[model samples]
Target: MDKKATVQKSGMILPRDLSERSWERIGSSLRELTNSSAWWLADWLIFGEATYGWRRYREAIERTGLDYQTLRNYAWVARRFEHHRRRDSLSFAHHAEVTRLSPPEQDYWLRKAEQQKWSRNELRKAVRASLAEQTRELSPSQSNGDEKQEVTQLSESAGADKRRKVARLTIELSPGQLDYYSKVAAAHGLSVDKWVTQVLDAAERRTA
Candidate 1:
């Protein structure tokens, strides 16, 4: 029990005249705790819900004094990522931003975020931009559900082996048309080929 600094479940308490070294240590400790608290709460909720069924939410809210919906959202993000899949470099908020993503995408964006040192808000913006690009690639007539599935299918189609039937089509494009498609595809982080497939698939769906 150092009189210079104290870290507790309620919050950190520090002396007014702490040494620079003590202050630095307390700051480091606080950072670790701040980063970890979400995962800890999430795992706690998951275990409690599994063990207590529906009673867990009631007891957790009363004991923790946390908002019920926030707690539920935290647990949902936790359940989306397994312990092994969780990234040490990113915070729970980063994971929360990617919860709407597909399984493969969850890993993709997390790795990008960790490597690029993106903040939670930055990740959220990037995810939103990506979704918007996909929606734009899909026509306005399609629902967000269709756009989400299109993105997931694109990711899977990239690495997957095509075992089913295939038909090849060759379309002649003007130079201007080719350049336009390339720019559109590059903006959306897609290849011109994939962009064409996405456009064609969306058109087929609209007609169907």
Candidate 2:
């Protein structure tokens, strides 16, 4: 090894490797990357060198007749470093908060929270194990809002022979419309009626 050749670690830059021309290019690349909110330059620098090192190791192994598995392991390590670096850039926790739920449920929570602007505490409360106790008796559709749902229970028609009557309304939907409804409903795990209500509610809120 040349005494002047600096040891490069995975995902890091060494001052000794900078030629005047390379230093100027790096400075230019950094400025462009920073302006575009591409903050993974540090990660790229580290991974890029690791990849070069892996190629060198493989060549040396072949020349010296060393174990193929050892070189393979080195390649795997380099790939893993790249994977972790990209994932870390996404700012996700090591263990997701809602890991027990289905993937769609997890996506729903993430998107819904972002759309509704929920605070961390509010998000935790909304998805708490005992959510029913804290939440109002509304369908999943109605619970889409960030605000607390209001309950307006009326006294059972006091002394007027308390009776509850149910009303049913039916409408015909075209095959294409029905398909669209099913697709939307399946995405949210809601009934078609619930999905329609949610769409209308969101529209109303946006207009308001």
Candidate 3:
């Protein structure tokens, strides 16, 4: 069968007793430990346990003597980091080697976490939902990876040149009509040119 067909078939197949047993064991462990904790704590526990690299995380927890609360917060941060990494399909090292982040990396990830304010599981879900690769093809030196920058750099000047070559429409407006157009544009929170475009678009739609 094709890959899609196999996935669909797997989705159709109900879990057997063994799968149920494994899920029950894992779920019960999670519920028992995390039930009294905050939602974020519970999320982190689940995500950390589910994903690989628990032994290293455990060592960090053990060495630091991080209270349950601190652990919970770490989980929250990890969740955020993982979320963006997964979305971008970018590989990030776990908290090892004590390496400092570059200013841009710090700014980008911090802003990302602040914006999303994700819990542990939600962060993991975001990671899982991230694209296979980040859309922007970045060189090692570039910090801002906005793909639109490339398109803009290539297209904007050319587009402007092309636009400049086109003849602009000139229409004579009576004083009354100009006043009415201004009022309509102001009412719609548009500039006069945008208002005219919108009016033309509406007219075209009606004709169509």
Candidate 4:
């Protein structure tokens, strides 16, 4: 970006001969912003709803440029997970995966995802598998039918799983750094890799 681009409010302009390094950095920041936007919008909607009642929906739609249903869905997920219960290691989509589950169940799966570093689709599969087991254990009756329907809805809510390409990131660490990360990860019952990723994610969100 040029110096003029930094001060420009209308849009960001790239330099004619921008370095690949600079473009990569820009893309990385954009990805972080996209990921953090879910939590940020959800939290904002929750606060607005609490303070302004039903009228908040209209205000939110106008201010955020997000549809009413999307805003509503965000609020529902945010309401399901209290601030303390959210998994910093996981994306907001990960929490949405277990929104219909009981609080303890949500915590259980989130902890597993954090420890295993599962992607959103992986977490969805694990949750559906468990729910299927429960359905299988039940007798064929109205209640069992209802449970099956609920499971279907949960599956549908995740939308299409296009299975986008994933890029693996590797970081080198000193022995002392490894030990420190391990201890902190253990304190939070997460793997060292997960802990490191979570810390990095939090830092990104703070700046975003």
Candidate 5:
């Protein structure tokens, strides 16, 4: 008797086999549901948490191993753009990227993302560029004057072109510190290079 043939003919499902089959079915269902329902669920939970308070919400989030920041961003998007049906086109990360913007700006960026099919990183760069443009427009004087002069002088040497050559620096950091630094860079809409440059520039200003 062929053991494989016997097992198949008997229609026997072993415990491990049953578990695997069940998980496959459940996993497929979850993937389908998550595409649409996750953000909605997050928004609902956030509302419930706010109405009842953090302790209740905190327990629920901890039990699920979900990030609180993720839920908070979902809730913000839900509330801030409740009327916009197009929001479903983007992922939670995409929407979260624009949560810092005013409603109009959020809608603008979301539309841009949908039309361009931008990846999260691309969207991040666009958002940062938009923010930097706005900052420059709002504070022209800050971008000019003594601060600009000091930065130009510090970054360049005598007889060099107006454009300074990029400098390279290396540093070691623990995984946790590196993660934190990346988060800070993302928040400022800057690359690691730009963020580090700004930090050094700020330090120089303070000293001078």
Candidate 6:
């Protein structure tokens, strides 16, 4: 059968003899849909259903014609970063890579992703590196007296001299406040830490 006839009969976009023009058009349309905010509609639906109950979540996923894995990724992203900043420039794949991390580690790798313009593969590598570093830091061998002392001394020296060079400041915020700041920072193409630093520096300059 011809391409149009096959599509009309089977309601399938994919056909062995599909025309190049038709294929390109379909691809473009799908890309546009994925790029639009509509892509998150499934996420919101999944979130609502999950809040109601597991049965409802499963039913909604089926009703919406979304696969479980895709819905699961959205749900995971929502729960993981519920009170954290999300970068618009980063795709869902990027967020998915860091979902297994602690909140602070999530922020650390995400910030690196933003600064480095990492592809999803690159983000995966960064996450792996971060995990390795955490594992090394938490090793029992590092807890011995001499090693602990050395670590303490090195940490103290780093804290003292590094602050002079990079100037670290600590501030506590409610979850809501942190989320808002994160959104603002991501919008400006800066991580929360870098954004806060720039804001402080700007204030200092104005005062000066």
Candidate with top lDDT is 1
| Leading candidate by TM-score | 1
Candidate 3 backbone overlaps, count: 1
The stretch of ten residues in a row with the least summed lDDT in candidate 6 is: 148-157
Give the TM-score of each candidate. 0.61, 0.26, 0.21, 0.55, 0.44, 0.48
Candidate 3: stretches off by over 4 Å: 1-167
lDDT, candidate 5, 1-208, per-residue tens: 2122123554633353345556576666656567557577666776778787989878877888877777776676666656454466677677778877644456667777898999778999998986686465333211233222111212322245576454434444554554566557656645344566678889878998
RMSD of each: 12.2, 14.6, 17.6, 18.3, 14.7, 9.4
Least well predicted 10-residue stretch by lDDT in candidate 5: 145-154
Q: Order the candidates by TM-score, highest first.
A: 1, 4, 6, 5, 2, 3
The residue pairs found clashing in candidate 6 are none
- Candidate 5's clash total is 0
Candidate 1 backbone clash number: 0
Model 4 global lDDT (CA atoms, 0 to 1): 0.68
**Candidate 1 lDDT score at position 104:** 58
Count clashing residue pairs per candidate. 0, 2, 1, 0, 0, 0
How accurate locally is residue 107 in candidate 3, as Cα lDDT from 0 to 100?
35
Q: Candidate 3 lDDT, tens digit per residue, 1-208? A: 1111112533533244445565566566545444324334545565656674778666655766757566655555455444333322221222211114322233333345446664445544443343222223211222234331111111111264475232234444554555566566555544345556566668877998
lDDT (CA) per prediction? 0.71, 0.46, 0.43, 0.68, 0.61, 0.62
lDDT of 1 at 146: 22
lDDT tens digits by residue: candidate 2, 128-155:
7334642443333222244333222212
Clash list (residue pairs), candidate 4:
none
The residue pairs in collision within model 1 are none
Tens digits of per-residue lDDT, candidate 6, 1-208, equal 3365234554555777878887888876656557444337545765677587878767766887867786665666767765346766676677778887546557767887888999889999867875576455333122334222111110111355465333323455555566677667666755455566667678877998
